[model samples]
Target: MAARDPGASVPVRAAVARQAVEWLVELQSGEAGDATRAAVQQWRAAHPEHERAWQHIAAVNARWRGAAVPSPLAHAVLLDTPAVPARPLPRRAAAKTVAALLCAGGGAWLAHQATPWREWRADARTGTGQRRTIVLADGSQVSLNSGSAVDVRFSAGERRLRLVSGDILVSTARDRAARPFIVATAEGELRPLGTRFAVRQHAGSSRVDVFEGAVAIRPRDAGQAPPRVLQAGQQARFSAAAVADTRPADGDSVAWADGMLVASGMRLADFLAELGRHRHGRLGCDAAVADLRVSGSYPLADTGRILDTLRATLPVEIHFITRYWVSVRPARR
Candidate 1:
């Protein structure tokens, strides 16, 4: 072959690199079996560049599995591949360059592993005093407060999360055709009809609060009863029975995400209960002080400062049983 035009080979390499990346994704999902392997083999047999690309991907996989290959060396392998030819080569001889071609595509595959979508999602849990917000590929926003766990799944037909523990605030964005978003817990499945809501899972039950638009609640199995539609500002609890007995969500109820705990004339005990969920330890109030009125918005991010503020305002004493345990008792008159 006459001298190949260097620029003519660019698109060929680019196309091969793209195809290799897709293959890498498929392989990571555990779906590339015999037939897929055969297809890859055929591609490799057709071109040396294809074989190079596959080899690069294999090297990256080996590194991810704790092989001794370093990232710098892997990158070098990809960058060192020969330039593409101006004309397509004879198919059989192309296998010579497969390893070099794979190197060109492996970088992206390695980076994908660092992303949440590529990682094995679900079984994700947060420890006390920890919060995480994740953006799903489908454009959904999920904000998990302290001590929470939820499994996320998105398919072409549905977006779902099974809340195994703790709380999650989901703001579902409008899909191309406005698909429904559903969050399921032990209590039931809360389907947001293209709206934003928060699901809080407790020991024996779970709560759903709709902040925007409408949502529907149904049992997990969907055999017992029909789903109930909940409008904005409506809240419900799923326990022994689906209870619509809900109060208005004040500023305090939704302020914790912003580090504020808004308590609007709530009981001392109830306020403490709410605060305890956002902290790393336990908080309690003595029986005598349990009924004391709590009417201020405290900082959820800094529980210690909030407790100090409470001490200065209320006629109570803060007791520290341990770093993780605390209680309050009414001050003597």
Candidate 2:
């Protein structure tokens, strides 16, 4: 697509590592028009990492381009879902094509795009930037946030919902079986008291906010320790070991169910982390502005507009190397 990086010093990350391969696939397919070429030129100048990643992919792809299949790289990445060919890419060529992306420290992020059995096999799952609502057999409604998944199980004694990944909002339905409704995460289980609440599964802990009624937090490691009961208007996070102290619940916890993110005196880094969940790829805030306070009610569907909002109101600049790679830095003074 574009020439080598020449010489640029920047870590390849965000979508640069992934987008580079897609651009190469387009060029190698001999279908890229003049417009596509011009866009590639502009993308190369977007940031140093973009150039570096583009060059690296082209360089490595050259090594595997002459395999048994004539168009191995073209069909391998399936960049943003390119046109399907009459024939599928062979396993040998496909592996090498994916290997092209599994380079540098960014392999983890792109690798996530591959098969994630847990999320894929989940009974209910939402893709990046998407949400879903499913009605259970007992009429209970569960709402899944972006990049979320859940598995529903019912038994004679309990109505159980497992949070495989991401967050969920539960609206319990009175069951004819009269079973207690419970939600489980990696760290603990939540038993709702005929009320509506939101549960978020984090890396090391699980957070629950009681918007309507009380709930009990039972940590997996809480041997003789009784479950912590959280009343309405309270929130708590718990690990397998113990539950943290309760705090005043934020009404904004359920706002995502309505497609909005509400921030009130929230740190910029925290704000971006929440917003990033509704988006694909990376949305990072520089440490320099990490603690800056932000307050607003932003729509989840228009993440780009939210970034534009920060640029207009805060002392910040938004750098967009690609649609999938964006960063927020202090405004250049």
Candidate 3:
């Protein structure tokens, strides 16, 4: 771990905050090694806030590290396997079912790793940098993006998910006609009465953006709570201490699942701040030039080229402190 630059000013800390997002992005793409641990240690030592940021990231991963790699919905779809009945499944049979779904390992061992056997049949998920789509036995499709996790449990009452982290886009397939689909996050739960929607969990809160159809949100800890319903072209942000916040839904917000970043006349700083989530190194801007605005569709697959394009079009500079560390500042002023 490296020591913090004692003389570093506030701007430097801001730059690091931006860099930290990128580090998190990279860490998700692969396993964090010794170098990563050292970097985290150094970031933690830099300032108290850095430690908080790192802990938030670490906490998200810790939640899923040992959890079972869920079997994809594809099993029930492509394979034409019937839904595991809602009734209590025998332990040995359930293990086989889970193992069959993951295909990488056996279910018995994984079942042992999950906590609270009751929640065992509950929904299971993967974490950041992971993408998976499952077709439920009933034909619904679920596609999850990186840094996201979820647990699923379907019964006569509802199709539920405990969203651990990240995001998911779901298009319900015809299931038993009327069983509602619900997704729960720290902030609240989204129950889609209609067919398609996306749910994302972040910073102890959750956001629901519906592209088509309607969904209802209920905070997990609330008793007899009246859930707020959202229809197409609408979005909602929910948290523990706050009532659900609803607003117009932006079509572009869900573009990341397709590996695209659609920025609509966004500030250069803000765009970079978002881009930092997909790149591996630091991304900073000259404080003087940070306010410049940018608009376009950038491919998340080539973040380096995205930076290069920024340099060509804007009056800004890109600095690479290391292959994994980059900083954007004023054009070498």
The numbered model that scores best in TM-score is: 2
Cα lDDT, model 3, residue 47? 71
Candidate 3 error regions (>4 Å): 1-130, 241-245
lDDT of 1 by residue, 74-154 (tens): 332334222233343332222223333334334444342222221123446554566778887778888887756678777
TM-score on alpha carbons, each prediction: 0.60, 0.70, 0.63
Candidate 2: misplaced stretches above 4 Å?
1-116
Residue-by-residue lDDT tens digits, candidate 2, 174-214: 88878999899989889998888899888679999988878
Candidate 3 or 2, higher TM-score: 2
RMSD to native for every prediction?
A: 19.4, 7.8, 13.2
**TM-score, structure 3 vs. true:** 0.63
| Each model's lDDT | 0.62, 0.73, 0.60
Q: Give lDDT tens digits, candidate 3, residues 133-219.
A: 877766778887654556777788777767665678888765665777777676666778755888876666778888898887777
Off by over 4 Å in 1: 1-123, 177-179, 221-224
